[model samples]
Target: MRKTVIVQDSPPSVRLVQVGTEQAGQRIDNFLLRLCKGVPKSHIYKAIRSGEVRVNKGRTSADYRVEEGDTVRIPPIRLPRADEPRPVPPASFPVIYEDDAMLVINKPAGVAVHGGSGVSFGVIEQLRAARPQAPFLELAHRLDRETSGLLIIAKKRKALVALHDMMREGGGRKHYQALVVGDWVNDRQHIRLPLLKWLTAAGERRVRVDAQGKAAHTIITMQKRYGRYSLVGAELRTGRTHQIRVHLASSGHPIVGDDKYGSDEVRAHFARLGLERMFLHAGRLELPHPLSGEPLRLEAPLPPACLKILDYLEQHS
Candidate 1:
């Protein structure tokens, strides 16, 4: 959208601006969120719902995509106090691989990928602040905040689009390592379940196995079994929210320390055993290079605590 040229400092008023190529296709709410920095999300949603924000001179919802040259009317919003500018903390993460097109990071548990749901800052926000010179950076996939390991970030728009396509078509192979609560009897198993996302009575997001839900596929391969736990490799053929965790849990073996799906007793027991975080890790990612025809297999070793738990399980079991 047209930047400072449309708004004057002293004489602030309703400004109708034309969308630019770079800003095109972005949801008006997101566009407004960036433009109206520091404004609370509730205010943004209310403004859109109240028709205070207009696209192409017509009232639009928050999900409407802004087209190039489309006129967007932005209401005069109160700016955040000059003395209290919330800044994205520039934090560095362990870098696994990096190139002109993509970057791979071994993300740690408890850090959100992007801020929302009470999180003030996430990997993307921090990465943007870390390198102000970088023009474009976007997450290619998501990992649960409590899960740690390999994550991909695209440095170019084309790369992001290609990665999305690869993931959507099931061309990319994503595998995670999880320590479950019980021994895995099968050497290998394919789980084809329809998963439906629903809100619990407490308004928390949850997924359940339902015939009416979207199709999801996961392949569980037995790796090693402990006296009371099993280390399994989960290969996802279709990516869905909490796919691996939910699939394994549905099969009667919830992941250890998975507060969302695991048994409370098991989680508590594992926490007391020093496995404070979810015992799942995105240990490997394999796909053809988006630009190059060459094959690419990226791997991230489990964190020290996870390895120590595995060692303990091995030695004790």
Candidate 2:
């Protein structure tokens, strides 16, 4: 059974009557070890050190003094579990454009942009697995896992270098489609926000708009609208982590299925409409060819799942 106890005073008191008898003057971490059997000592120490396990309803140092009736709130442990079996590589990921120097793919939603952490395989890995003899294919940029659409991969080192340089020179055009929570009256608007990195309790990276952070800019155009939601097109002038999602959310028009930034009402409404993933897609990309020097433009059609949601909205609206 689980139980909760409130800390009402300093040197927070804890009553672990069922687990073990309290020992006076013991370090908080040591006391927790006796109370929580089979749990790693390091884990307990980390919890105390990180301030997750609090004393007296306040953050405390690991060396915090403890008394007979002090209350301690020991948060449950959360550790990364062992790796699971790898997912099977897709038989074929649709190719939107291909040439000697570079290739563009219409990446499906639920597929990672690149491999990291315990993810042994991602779109880039699968692509290399499919073409073992290809020199090397490097991702020019990245899209979120739940986002689908045009992604460019360079087939050679030279191509990768050229494409990276082109991106830096502002020579590429990227367009995205997103379903936002509210009707936007303005046909076109520019969002200039700065983004800063934050690390969560679980050590996951997140981005937020702060004046002290890196500059980001995006241009939004109203593509169409339903009763309450609007399908908008976004063009990024400066690429930043979750730039569009953060900007639109800050404007009080969060993207559908974006639980991190979207409102609960919007999330529930989209869920009722069968939207399971973020309703965003990288629809179009235009850049100069690495080898041919010709302008290369590619379009990735909306995935079937995205279309289904749009179709439902059309019918209901």
Candidate 3:
């Protein structure tokens, strides 16, 4: 008796997903991008434009904010199976603190906070891949790829919203340690400069001091001196893109190993001394608990390499 094989070809089908609280406030286009991995962005937008994507039985624009309990209709999309992108590898970092509502980790320098602008994957993606059972995980805030320290990841949507509100209302205190090239004269000083963001001819993002820009305030305190070099503590009063680096550079004391704003000669000199990355660290953060409103203070010590650089400066001086 010969067994007969059964095969049936079926076309791709539409999918309806209900938005959860954790995914609220995200634009529809971004939501689809993450949901339909490996699909072209142009196709996503085209579907939205052609009224193929719908929310609550009504067509919505790509920029429409998704809310909890909203049903989203996703049209079937074909992805390139022959040249699919590699999967994000599971990764983890040093945990500074962890609770029900949040997870704080010591993010290392050179790893992006999230994948974008040519980066295929970053800390968030890796963490999500590592903890596949996690229901909700989102970044409370972002740190530049070159800066390393206590980075917060919210475990709940309510916690994330509270953290964003706290940041916007200046309810937290953030401090950074930067090793600069020149001897800083001020024992303590407040640098209040407005910063304007612009794109260079190559489309690279850059921030500069301009009157028509957003106000940025940084409180600087000289921590130590090593001949021509000085270690300074920067307290961010108003957080802006590249605020501390731009402020220090504008004051003629660019940070050591800062390629974007520091002197070429200074960076080369520090490179010889074993400082390859930017000498900036987010050392401390003081704020009230996002969910409980209890005051909390978190700190991450400087990396071993940064400490070694300081030791070298001390011995040479």
Candidate 4:
């Protein structure tokens, strides 16, 4: 007769782990994300960025690949008491275009491009669920949760990489439509500002115009005026998070219903009118096809909510 011994998995706590043959060649970020059960992706990234995660007694980056026998120092993490309570319901957005190489969707407002910052799941998660048979799918770029319109998804790894390279070299033309609180002074305006991102005391993300920040450029074309507000077309020359929102606010004409950068008074005023969100839309996106080298231009009409607000402005004015 032979006796066998079993080892019990340990509880969640600060611990050191050694990479084994099976774990070798995995990115440190992905390894930790799988090892730390129930830890949010945001928390894992934060720890890596803040130098709390170490490898072999030295600070390591997220992209560092694990080698056999490399000791990883993982900090104590607070896991959710329960696993994601609800499964992501399978859903799909309005498809603007689809092909073997890629897909373009008219992403609705209030849905995050990908989940983080207290969101349990988002477009990518739901899309994967909806198309379980599809082997590869990934976001080519991101859109703010409050902003609506055209979004691109790559159905192949090669397409994803190619799109990234193209965007990096400024190959895409993205245009937005926004309604600002006051009449824009210039019919056409070029805003060149540097934007710095920082966190508030409450740990909220915010962006401001700063001389030392990354260079951001935006071109604004004033569309029409309705008493207290002006609709304008904003062309993004450099795609930065909150670039358009902060740039317009810096110029003294904040986008309407932009609670973070715009006025609280204006938000309340619009909220009372059933117009509860920032009036910003990704109206057009023109990009070269990753595989075919053909130019593809995608457009999404403004949502009904935005149309209702415009109608209200016209009738009330």
Clashing pairs in 3: none
Q: What clash count goes with each model?
A: 0, 7, 0, 0
lDDT of each residue in 1-317, candidate 1, tens digit only:
33223322432467777776556656788777766656777888898999989877899999998887788887777766668756677888999888999999999988899878788778987997788677567788898899898999988756877899999999979889999988799999999999999998988889999999999999999999998899999999998999998999999999999999988998887778888899899999989888775788999999898998999999999
TM-scores vs. true structure, each candidate: 0.91, 0.70, 0.90, 0.79
Which of 2 and 3 is ahead in lDDT? 3
The TM-score obtained by model 3 is: 0.90
Model 2 C-alpha lDDT versus the unseen true structure: 0.76
| Candidate 4 stretches greater than 4 Å from native | 1-61, 65-86
| Candidate structures ordered by TM-score, highest first | 1, 3, 4, 2
RMSD of each: 2.5, 16.2, 6.4, 6.7
Best by TM-score: 1
Which residue pairs in candidate 4 collide? none
Q: Mind giving the per-residue lDDT tens digits that candidate 4 earns over 96-145?
A: 99998898999888899876788877898789768867756778899989
Off by over 4 Å in 3: 1-11, 38-51, 78-86
Model 1: CA > 4 A from native = 1-12, 81-83
Kindly give the stretch of ten consecutive residues in candidate 4 with the minimal lDDT sum. Answer: 1-10
Tally clashing residue pairs in candidate 1: 0
Candidate 3 C-alpha lDDT tens digits along 1-317: 11111121122577778787668887899788767755767889999999999998899998999987788888878744546654777899999889999999999999999876788778998998789778678899888888989899999878999999999899999999999977899899999999999998988888999999999999999999999999999999887999999999999999888888898988888778887889999999999999999999999999998999999989997
Specify the highest-lDDT model's number.
3
The Cα local distance difference test for each model comes to 0.85, 0.76, 0.87, 0.85
